[model samples]
Target: MLRDIDPMGDQASIIGGVIEFIKEVQQVLQSLESKKQRKSLSPSPSPSTPKSLHLPAKPNPMGEVGACFNSSLADVEARISGSNVLLKIVCQQIPGQILKIVAVLEKFSFDVLHLNISRMEETVLYSFVIKIGLECQLSLEELATEVQQSFFSEPVFLNEI
Candidate 1:
């Protein structure tokens, strides 16, 4: 329903404004209706996007040179099987600390699976999930202690959780 009926005033301007307003309202209502229709069509929750399960791409040092190499050569020194270790550490708010942590893990012969880093206020939180063979030379406790000692310092707290 349109209101503000004008008799002597500029009818064209008032009518134009009303038309624009109606168009906007119609667009909004159409969007809402479409959303409702979609929801009704999919009463059950849609399956989660497969993209969520994808792990982040790790940096490959060998680059294109290794790409052309034999596939069997890549599997020669593989130690870890299907098991992995998840490590979470909180450290001082600084730069290059994560790189150091990764270097330590590599030094200990642990293959990093997934790593996530976040900052909570003044502290930096790091989560590293690693994979190691059942015959891994270093024990989990030993590795955790070594990592903690390597990264621990004043204003930095390292913990594996």
Candidate 2:
């Protein structure tokens, strides 16, 4: 006899977490490969053709760092005003991801005021507005850098797209 499946139970949650972890691992590996390719030259030996006869290969428009955020993956943003800080992170479902983010926030002296978590398919979106007491002393730039460094393995540059 076939048993009924419950999507809200522990077993289902464990499987989903495993799938998310695997996806993140694959993303990191692909990023490493792209970096290596950008750093190394073509392995083929030099051709005998005259320099005038051969055309130079076009460079990769994306360059060495490549795309930092994939639309299908994740995006992180931080907004600051006085002692109020708002952080928005939209990402694929990752195991213990929210806890990790919260831990980092605590280290930076930001107290979580409110948190909203919404799920779409396998993605989890987190919206947090935090408050820092007068005693908390960290500039916005420093806070932003710390957030990226703790949450991301790669160096992230903010660009308006």
Candidate 3:
């Protein structure tokens, strides 16, 4: 004899499982949508601002630096002297945290020349190339030290975005 199945118990189990699955899907969808929104909201440079801007030249440490009456010339020379420094960093995927990295660069007087980001399964990797001008007093070592001390000190989560 086949025992009759309890319809109420079976129905309740199915309904409960469906509800749980729906909640999980909602959470994952929300996370992905938030990430998209954060990326879209990032501020882009204005058209008026040139792709590369230069700082004034300074004394070469061993020789006197010549002055140029034209500000454009001075700007161009400064940029020519200050090439970009490339760095790679890996961190937990987080939204709105790029600003913190930018802040660190600004603190060290490094101009952000270019930035590229890649997202892996569990990590967000940043590749940044920056230029430091002669006007900036900090050396490469000092800048790197400061950035490491400030930005990489703690693990960052994506809760802010």
Off by over 4 Å in 3: 1-82, 152-161
Q: How far is candidate 1 from the true structure (C-alpha RMSD, Å)?
A: 22.3
lDDT of 1 by residue, 48-131 (tens): 311111122232453311111101001001122236665655444555566666767887877888775555445444556688
Alpha carbon lDDT of each predicted model:
0.47, 0.53, 0.49
Q: lDDT at 76 for candidate 1?
A: 7
**Candidate 3: residue pairs that collide:** none
User: Higher-lDDT candidate among 1 and 3?
Assistant: 3
Best by lDDT: 2
For all candidates, what are the clash counts?
Answer: 1, 0, 0
- Clashing residue pairs in candidate 1 are 80-133
lDDT of 3 at 27: 42
lDDT of 2: 0.53
Specify the poorest-scoring 10-residue window by lDDT in model 3: 68-77
Error of 3 at 32 (Å): 23
Clashing pairs in 2: none
